[model samples]
Target: MPILDPLSFECVSHSDEQTQRLGARFAQAIPPVCVVALQGDLGAGKTHFARGIGMGWGAAQELRSPTFTMLQEHHREPDAGARLYHVDLYRAERAEDVASTGLLELLEDNDGVIVIEWPERAWDQLPPEALRVRFAVTAPSKRNLTFSTQSASAWQTLLKFRKLAFGV
Candidate 1:
C-alpha cells in the first residue's frame, strides 16, 4: 500500500482544451467521497484543473472559478450520481470567516467530492484524509502539479495512482 507516495507530472497544454485533458485524467482517478484541496496563485490554473474534476463527476454546467459565487455544485455525466462541489475561499478575510460560508457543514452533510480553492484559508478546517494538490506555473500554459497526502496510507495510494497514471 504505497498510496502516500508523492507523485508529480508535467503537461504542456494551452487554452481550455488542455485544462480539460488534465481534468479528464483527474476525473477518472478520483473516487467518491474524496476531498481535494487545490492551491495556486491567481491565474495559476487551479480552476482549470478543477474543471477536469467537475467534468469527471459528470457536471454539465459551465465550469468557472467560484471566486464570487463561493461555491457551486455540479454533477458528472448521467450515470454518476456523485456530485462535485466547487468551492472558492479566495475572498475570506480570515480563517474564522470560512465558517460563515457553511462550507464545512456542506462537507459534513453529503460526504461527496469537494474541490476547494485557496485551501490554505481553511488549513485547520480540512479533515485528515483530504488530498492536497499544489500547482506552480512552469510556463505560460504549463503547470507543475504535485499531489501530497497527509495520511501515511493515503500518500502511498495517491503515489500509486499517479504512477499508474503517468506510467513512469
Candidate 2:
C-alpha cells in the first residue's frame, strides 16, 4: 500500500446518523481480526461510528467508548464468536503504559475485531496493516472522514467498502 494520502478515500457525513450510516456498511463488510485505528478529537463521533460498526458486526449490545474503563466488548450482533473490541487510550499517559496493556497479545488473530480510539496515543502499538480512520468535525452536525490502509488487503477492502457505502 502507498503511504496513505488523505485523498485515497473520502466520506462526508452531516450528522451522527450519517456517520453511523457509513459505518454500518463498513461493519457489515469487515472481516475478522481487523485492527482499526480511529483518530479524532474530543466528541469526534468515534463512539457513534463504532456503534454503527457494532450493529453491523452483529453486536447484540450497545457500544460505548470504554474511555475510562479502557476496554469494552460488544457481543456480535445476532451471533457469537464474531465480535468487536472497543478500546480507548485517552487516559493512558505514556507509550509504555499502552505497551504494558499487551498490545502484541491482542493482535494474535483472535476471532473478534479490535477498534482503538485515541490512536495517536498508541501509535507504536498498532498493527502495521491496520485501517486508519481519521474523523474531523467540521460543525455541530458535519464531519469529514478519511480512510487509509497500510497493507494491500486493507486498501482493497477499503476501496470496495467505500463503494458499497456510497452505493456507486
Candidate 3:
C-alpha cells in the first residue's frame, strides 16, 4: 500500500558527524522489525549514516562497513535488547548472490535492525515495508539525505522520524 500521507523530508550534512546525527535520529524514530534500504553512490555517506544508526540504537561496539567482508554484526547493550546487522551488497551484482549472502534469511528473522548499502541490487528480495533512504553527494564534504516509505506502516514510522529529525 502507498503511504496515505506521502511525506518527504530533507537534511543537509556538511560532515560525517552531522550525517551520523541525522541517522541517529532515524534509528530512534524507526520501529522494530523494520528494514532500512539505502541507495547512494560512493562517498555518499551511507556508511557514516549507518554508524550513527548503531550508536543511536545503543550498540555496544564500533560500527564498521562490511564492504569487503559483506556483513558485520553489532550487538546492543543488554538494556537495549537489540542488534544491528550491517550489510553491503556492492559486490553482489545478482539477486542470487544477494540470496547467497543470506540477506533474505536475515530479513525473515527480523530480530533487529538491518542497514543495507547498495540495496538496489536486491530490490526484488526486499520487503515492501522497507524505509527507503536516498543519499546524494552535493559537495566535497556535504550530502543530501532523503527518507521515504512505501507501506502505510513504514510511512507511520517515517513520520515519527520526521517529527524527531525536523520537528514537523
Candidate 4:
C-alpha cells in the first residue's frame, strides 16, 4: 500500500470479488445524496463494483448496467423512499443526450444517490462535488481503481472508506 492523499487514493483489486468489496466499503461511507462518476472502459469492473454498492446500500434488487435503458432505479428496503439511481451514458454522444435522461433534475433534487457510468459523455452536467472513480485493467482478472474528488466532504467519505476497507 502507498501513502494516500486526503483527496485521492488508489486500490488494486486482484479479482472481481475484491473490486465489489471495495465498492461495498465505499457505499458504507457515501452520503445519502451524492453522485459517483465511474470512468473506465467496458468490462473494467464498473457494474460489478456498482453491484456491491447496491448490496451494501441494501437495495431491493441487484444493480445492473443501464446501458440500453439509460437509467435504473433501485429502492432500499425498510425505507423504500431511499433510492439508488444508476445511470449509463455509454450511448450518449452529447450533453443533450444526457439531458434526455433527466439526470440534471435528479441532481438538483438531491433525491437519492446516483452512480453514473460513462460520465465523460456529460462532464459539464456533473456536479463539481461528484466523487470520481477511474478504473484500469492491469491483467485478465486484475484492476486498479483510483478514487478522487476535490470536495471536502467527498474526501472525508473516502477517508472513512479507506479505514473500513484497508484498516489504515
Candidate 5:
C-alpha cells in the first residue's frame, strides 16, 4: 500500500431520504471508475445510500442489498454497457473470501462504478484509492455520515459533492 494524504468531511442526515439524496449528489460527482467502501452497522442506511447512487448513475434497476448473493450488477440506461456493481462483504469471514468474489477484477474495471457495503470484512483487499464512507445512527431517523478518501481525485470528487449538496 502507498502512503496517502487523507481527506475527509462529515454530514448529518435527519432522515433516510436525506441520506439517499446526499448519496445521489455524491454519485453525480464521482468518477466512473471509482470504488466506494461503505462502513456501518446494520440499519445504518448503507443500502439506501447505494440505491441513491444507482438512481443518480442512471441504473435501469433499483440497487438492493446483496448480502446473500454478495454481488449485484445493475446496467445503466443509454449506455447499456455501463454498469454499477453493488457488493456486500458482511458474510465474508476472511480476505480470501472477498477475493473469491472477483472484486479484484472489478477494481481494475474502468468502465463502471463499484459500491461496497461492510468493507471492513476485506479492508486489506481494497485499493488505496477507494473512497470510504462511515455511517452512524444518531437517532431513530437520523444518521451521521463521514466520507473519507486517500486518493486525490476522489478527494476532489468529494469536495465537489459537498459543494453541490451543502453549498459550502
Candidate 6:
C-alpha cells in the first residue's frame, strides 16, 4: 500500500451522540493492532468517543473509563482472540510509569487495538505509526476533532473512516 500524505482532517461534533457515531465509524474502519493517541482536555469527550469505538469493535462488556483501574480490556470473543485496550495515562506522571503498566508488552503481542488518553505524557514510548487525534471544546455543545497519521496503514484507515463517517 502507498503511504498517504500526513494531512489532518477536522470534524465538528455538535453532541455526544455525534461524537460517538463518528468514533464508531472510525473504529469500524481502522485496522487491528492500531494505536490511537487521543489528546484533549477534560470533558473533551475522549471517553465518549472511546465508548463508540468499543461498541463498533464489538466489545461484549460495558465500556467505561479506566480512570481508577488505569487499563480496561474489551473483548467480544476471547476465542477469536481480538482485544481492545483502553488505557488512561492521566494519572501517570512519567514514561516509566506508563511503561510499567505493561503497555509495551501488549503492543508487542499485537492482540488488538489500543486507544490511549493523555498519550502526550508518554510520547516517546508510543509507536511512530500511531494515529494522533486532537479534540478541542469549541463550544458547550460542540467539539472539534482532528485526525492525522503518517503510517501507510494508519493513513488508509483514516481515509476509510472519513469515507464511512461522511460518505465522502
TM-score of each: 0.82, 0.89, 0.91, 0.95, 0.92, 0.91
Counting clashing residue pairs in each candidate, in order, gives: 18, 4, 0, 0, 0, 0
lDDT of 5 by residue, 56-153 (tens): 88899989899989999889878998878999988888877888777777876645798999998877767778889989998999888888887777
Model 5, residue 5: displacement in angstroms?
A: 9.7
Q: Rate the local accuracy (lDDT) of all candidates.
A: 0.74, 0.78, 0.84, 0.89, 0.85, 0.83
lDDT of 4 by residue, 13-75 (tens): 999998888888889989898999999999999988888899999899999889998999999
Ranking by lDDT: 4, 5, 3, 6, 2, 1
Name the runs in model 6 displaced over 4 angstroms. Answer: 1-6, 78-80
Worst 10-residue lDDT window, candidate 5: 1-10
Q: What CA RMSD would candidate 5 show?
A: 3.8
User: Using lDDT as the measure, which candidate wins?
Assistant: 4
Query: Which ranges of candidate 4 are over 4 A from the true structure?
Result: 3-6
Q: Write the residue-wise lDDT of candidate 1 on 71-93 in tens digits.
A: 88886566457678889999988
User: Which residue pairs clash within candidate 5?
Assistant: none
> What RMSD does model 4 have?
1.3
Model 3 Cα lDDT, one tens digit per residue, 1-168: 123246655677889899899889889997766789989999899989998988898889868889887888788778566668899999998777798777999988888888999999988878988998889998999887788776877888888987888787
Q: Candidate 1, TM-score vs. the true structure? A: 0.82
Worst 10 residues of 6 by lDDT: 1-10
Runs of candidate 2 with Cα error greater than 4 angstroms are 1-7, 100-102
